[model samples]
Target: MDSTEVVVRSVRTVGPDTVALILESPPEFDARPGQFLQVAGEVDGEEIARHYTLSSPGADETFEMTVGIDPDGDLSPWLGEREQGDTLEVAGPFGRSYYEDEPRVVVLAGGPGVGPAVGIAERAMADGGEAVVVYRDDEPAHEDRLRGLEAAGATVLVTDEPLADSDDALDVLSEATGQVFVYGFADFLDDANDALAATGHDPDDAKVENFG
Candidate 1:
């Protein structure tokens, strides 16, 4: 899609230094879980833009992007300060690594990657599918939603330890069956690949979105 303005529907903190920025969906916007939008805003007399993945399960009327506040960064902190009715320029529901109604899914996430993990898992469950999330973050965000997913029968594991060092995470990877997905920074992706290899899962088979 071309660059257009979107209105902020709401903003609230989801976890420590993290905020869920809900925006009114643009007309004809057909973004799926794990896809991303390029959001732009003015900060310090210059326009700054960044790509944020869809954190909401679907883009019907409204959508959400999970922003990790960085006090010293260029854009995220500004995004966190947006209030209801604020407008921001956005474009494209970019990226190919997204959920597509698979019967079963396994998501391996790290840090802000938890956004898409939860989004994809929720969408899968809503479609009568199964989901398993192995997320690694020192301070997990979207805690309430994660717990809700667990209560709804999805297997969720949130840990602070590295995937290569966590026995339980490796065990789950070894036994779980599904269309695997991975989302994180480069280092985390490397660790996830190593963990997948250790568990006899083909790393190349996992649909990965690297947040480099």
Candidate 2:
């Protein structure tokens, strides 16, 4: 991972507990959709690092990362307090589950997992490919971006219901003829795989990024 000092350009609330941090990208910095960065900052006389996925389809000179703050967490609360011009150490354009120019793509995201899923869909659409997102969240994160994706002709299914409990959650998988990407916590990944299997879509065919 290459480390660089990046200045915060802006911060805005995307959800009740989530904030989008727009950081000034180094001239040489570049990352694909679905990749994450390790952000470290000094807090309480100690340095804490946390991984946050890049929340944009692509970037030229700036990028965004949406972070869901855990009130009880050490790093998130500290990060949430960051302001414009604050500097932080950043490393990585890491992670393997990136978007490919497939004929069609299906994104299954749970909760904050929507961050990367939205990016993937955006990139896919930019390449003239089809994308469908089945997003499950009680109180959604990145709602505006999701709506933007919808406006861009990507199909989006939003529901407060859990993906595992919804009978048709995985039905999109059956119709998909290209790649499938699943993003969520471990348990959600497991359930997503099971749902894929139940729908006759090979669970192994799906690229998974587990938050746990």
* Model 1 Cα lDDT, one tens digit per residue, 5-69: 99999999999999999999899999999999999999989999999899999999999999999
Best by TM-score: 1
For candidate 2, give the lDDT. Answer: 0.84
Error of 1 at 70 (Å): 1.0
TM-score for all predictions?
0.99, 0.94
Encode model 2's per-residue lDDT on 1-212: one tens digit a residue.
58889999999999889998898888778688888899998998999888888888886888888888999987888889999999889999888887756768888888778888888898999999999898888889888988988999988888777666776675655665668899888877887787777777788888888887
Tell me the whole-model lDDT of each prediction, alpha carbons only.
0.94, 0.84
Candidate 1's TM-score reads 0.99
- lDDT for residue 189 in candidate 2, whole number 0-100: 87
